[model samples]
Each structure stands twice: as structure tokens, then as C-alpha cells.
Target: MNCESIRNQFSSYLDGELASEQSRRVERHLSDCQGCHAQWLELQQLDARLQGLAVPQDLESRIVAAVGAETDAEQQAQPAPPPRGYRKQVVAAVIGLAAMIGLLAVWLRPNMPPVDVPPPLAAVVVRSIGNVQVRAPDAEGWSDVDGPHHALPRGSRIKTPQRGGCEVETATDAQLRLDANTEMVVHGSSHMQVLRGQVWCQAAPQQPLTLGTRPPADTAAVPDVFVCPAASEMQVRVDQHQAAEVGTEPVRKAWQLPLLALPGSDQGELSSLVETLLANVGHSKMQFMNADQIRALGPRGAIPLLMYVREPSSSQQPAVRRQAMQLAAEVADDTALTMLDELLADPDPQIRRLAEATVERLSVGSAR
Candidate 1:
């Protein structure tokens, strides 16, 4: 690749997000090109300086206060508080000042009111058939996605074992499927970096999916993004550090499309690292007392599980939901049960089996 192209990936390379071969290529280019190498060294120094600094404990609170406080313009719009010692000023002066203050406030008040906007949503991992895992942002290790708990942080990674693959859904209902032996780093809900293997994507009937691909060498200029019009599907696979697209195929809905549009909704809440351990029972299923035998488990065990089940934010991982369902029924936790009932309407056989088994188990226990 030329210097210009190589430089385009410097940010990703510095973040260690490049594929092995791609990373090696960049290293080679840096070694051969003095200009690029100098730039790279400078980048490394900047990163080191940034990393060595510690954030103040009140940094966040200070930032929030600064952002939420009235700006200088807003303060000025209130008319200087009548100068404090203006009691001697004539009544006409006071009347004129009041009239001018009202005019200024009306003219300088913001054109738009402050609207409370929620944070951006991300794609969630909804289906997993084999060994899948997700690595949280800035985390030191990868966690096996044994079951459930597939909500993704915007900058996190998801990978699958040789026989494993998973699906992700966006709030817009776009869905993407990762093939086995693939690693993908999601860039928000719409964009992703496919380091290896392939992905299938199907856009929602109304959502036009813009699939971003790695640009090609200078000699072969490729379009940066492919627009899969509403209701279309596409495939993207990595080859030689570039995304090679398979021509759009509108049919063949076997359910694994990484870049196509699919239906989605907001699911799952973000948790602190320690709190994550308690919430992620699906990642450590063995530690969970058998769902069928939770009768001996105390409120300590049951409350977190029930709380997780009832939380508005939850991924649609079948195992986690089913286990929570069992707990809800066992304790007669109507709210948790009601939440599960509403979420379980998909009737996908895998989910149906879980729902059916829960009902059957509950019924048989009552009969005894």
C-alpha cells in the first residue's frame, strides 16, 4: 500500500485493531519509509504522554457542571443585575433599563431549547449457536459467551470458534451475522471491522444499509461503501487486508448476514466490571445452581437473578432468559414473569422449547 493509504489506518493500527498481516504490512512500510516512521514515533510518544496522566477524581463532575451551566451569552442576556448601586438612577432610567433587559433576553435566548437526548444505541448479540465470545473495550481478557449476555459495547469485539457464529441486531432493526472463525470489532451500531472470515447482512425492509469496506490499493480504486437498498442483503469477507464484497443477493435467507439490514430493538444495560460478574450468569453457567432446582437458593441468589430478569435492559439470550423465567415462576415473582412472558413471544423453536419446558416443569411440580 502507498504511504497515504497506510497513514489512513494509523489510528486503527495504534489501537491494535489491525489484523496480524495488515499490522505487519504497516510495520514494514514504517520501516522502509523514514517519513512514516517519524510520524509513527511521534504518535507513540503522544500516546505515552496521554496514558501516563491520571484523571482527577472530580473531572467528570466538573465537566458535567461546566456543560450544564449557563453560557456567558446566556448570563449576559439577563442584563447585568441592575449594577447593584443604581438606586439613584432616575425612574425613567430604571423603566428603560427594564424594557431593554426584556428585549435582550428575548433576542439572545437560544433559538432552540435544550432537548434531552439519550445516548446512541448499539447492535446487540441476539443469537449464538456455537462457541462465541466478546471482549469488552480496554479489557485485558476475552470472556466466553457460553450463553445470553450478548449486548455489545460500541467499541468491543466479538469472535467465534471454528464452529461457532452469532447474530447482532441494531435499534433500527438491522441484523448482521458473524460466520465461524471470524473476529469483528463493532463501530457503533452500523459499522464494523471484520478482521477475519465473513459476515452477512440484511437490511430492514425500510432501512438502507451502508456497508463500509476497506479501500483497495491505489491501482484498484473500490467504492468505500456499498448501499444495500431497503430489503436487500449483502456479504462481506476479508481478503488481503481488504473487504471483498460478494455481489448483492436478494434471496437466500438462512439467517446469517453480517452487513445486511435486520430488525432490532434496544436491549441490555451496561454494568460496572464487578457488577458484570454477578449479572453474567450465562458466562458462568456452572456456577448457577440448576434452574430446575432453585428451591434451596436464598434471596441473595434469587434477588439479583430476579432483578436481572426484570431490568428493562436485557439481551435476548435464550438460556439466560429461560433460567430467569424458571426463577420468576418458582418465586411467584409476577413482574419478572410478566416481563419474560412479553419477551418470549418469538416462538422460535429454541425459545419455544425453553418456554414450554418452564411451563411443563412448573405444572408437574404443582401436580406433585
Candidate 2:
């Protein structure tokens, strides 16, 4: 036989399905042609590899069960008719009596108490203060929250007034701090939304948590403290004891503030640096400045930037406003507090909301 015809039947020949004459022809061709012999060796290798594969543990049982159930169903659906005879009527009567007895037994069965399915565990409010309210997913409006250790369900919303604040412990052992005038919605054990206000979160190292202003578009977990700001729906990751401001843009070094790293330097040099940084806030090259720069500036350096940001005419950008608010928080002092108060009456609703939250945080810090 030609080489092409012999090669096509190699698989069948390997499986012993080829006729005796065809198998002999293929073997003779392999022996004569070195190329065909190499091809035959490859086919043998492939067969060996396939034969060495292990079947899944449950595969055989699952296949048998599926096929058996299908056969039984088909058989039951088309049971053979009994031979036409006088016994047909008797069989019908017997079947009718058996069905009636089954129905009666079912009707007389005693009713058992319903199973008590536990509610899904969510975050617990470990601590709270004045004006803190919660609205469950089922509830329409806000209601006074129970004092402390209140377990909230998914879809529940917690709101803190101007003088209110709270701490929450999530199921994954993560800690969340909600500042005053903040509203947050619980999505699940590891997910939540910051509708308005500031939320400082530290997730467990092993099981990171997720925080977003809206439902997360991705399901990846983040292993960092997330700072969610009001107005702009974005999450900013910050280190512990560090602060950051999240705006419309992605997280950058400029938004982060390393309070501990600030140098105790002269105020004049810091002022010039702050001015330089603010001037470059919107520029592509200087879109952000690191916490070290801001910390070096200290509260004094942050003051001028705050004023420039709060100015009604200075580039009404959300990024500028958010950075200003964050810088104000870092420089939490009388002057910053006064600016935040002025921001309370700011025309932008988001800026006003953020200002209220910042004021609450400053008040808390001052009290401490």
C-alpha cells in the first residue's frame, strides 16, 4: 500500500482494530520506510502517554450513576402495558387504593417546627457615639442605632452625625474606623461601600478586606489600610498611622501623608516648597508629592496649600479639594480647623460633606 494509506490506518493498527492483511501491510511499510518507522514510534509514544494518564476518583461512579438514572427514568416513563386481560381492572383498582393510602398518610403527618437558619454574620459595631444611626437592608429610613456590640447584616447602612463616630470589627477580624458625618453600607463579610465621609480600615494580614465607594468592579482583595473619602468614590491605601487623600485620580504619593516623618525645619523654606508643590498639582510630571515632602513642610507648610486649595477661584478641581482637605487633616490645628469650618459652607456639596468629616476628626484629635 502507498505510504499515505498506510499512515492513515496507524492509529487503528495500534488499537488492534485493523484487519490482519492491512496490519501486515502497515508493518511491512514501517520496516521498509525509515520515515514511516519514525512516525510509528511517535504514535507509540503518544499511546503510552495517554495510557499513563490517571482517571479522576469520582469519574467512573458519576458516569455510571448518570447513565443508570437516565435509563431508569426512560423505563419508568414508558413502562410496558400489561397483557389485555380481566386482571387489568383489578390492577387499576389496586393502584388507586395504594395512591389513596399514600395521600392519607401524607395528610395525617404531623407538622414540625421550621428550621432555624442562622443569619449570615457581618461586621459588628464595637463602639459608637452620639448621632450614630443604622438602616438595615429591609428598613426604609434611618433609626437610632443600638449602643455597642451591634451585629449588622449585609446591605445595612451606618451613619454618624457631625458629633458621631464609631469603630467596627469585621468578620475577618479587620478593624474599621468611621469618622463623624460618615455613611457606609455593608455589602458582605469582606466588602463595604463608603457612601459619604471618611473610613479608615486595616484588614487582617492573612485575609485582606475590600472597601469601595460603590460596588467593586473587581474582586481582588487589597492588603492595606484603605481611606475612603466622601464625594469622590475611590479607595486610597495608606500605611498604619499614615494618612492619604483619594480624589478622582488613582492613588499617588502626593495624596499620602507620613505624619511621623515630618522634619522640624524652618517654616520659610517649607512654605516655598508647598507653593512649588501646589503650583505643580495638576501638571503631569508633578501630579503628586510624597508624604516626606508634606511632613517636612509640617503644619506651617500645609497652611498655604490649604488656603490655595480652599480659594473659590483656584482651579475648582476635585483632586485639589481632596488634597486640601487631607492636608488640613494632617495639619489639624486651629487654623486648619477654621478653614474646615469655612469649607462647611462651601458651595460644593462634596466639599461641604468632606469638611464636616474633617472637622469631626479634628475635634476628636483636639479632645484627645
TM value for model 2: 0.31
Q: Model 2: per-residue lDDT, tens digit, 1-368?
A: 78888889977876668765665566556545656665765665455434434444665455556555665686688897444563445445544554556546545777945544334557888777676888877778888877667888767889888876777777757766676677888865556667666766665533334465532335343222232221222433322223334433322223112211234323563554454455444232114666556656666655566666565545557676666656555655665777678878877786787778878877887788
Model 1: per-residue Cα lDDT over 154-196, one tens digit each: 5678898887678777655777778778887775554566666
User: In lDDT terms, which candidate is top?
Assistant: 2
Residue 167 deviation, candidate 1, in Å? Answer: 1.3
Count of backbone collisions in candidate 2: 1
Q: lDDT of each structure? A: 0.58, 0.59
Model 1 residue 271 distance off true place after TM-score fit, in angstroms: 39
Top TM-score hit: 1
Off by over 4 Å in 2: 1-118, 215-368
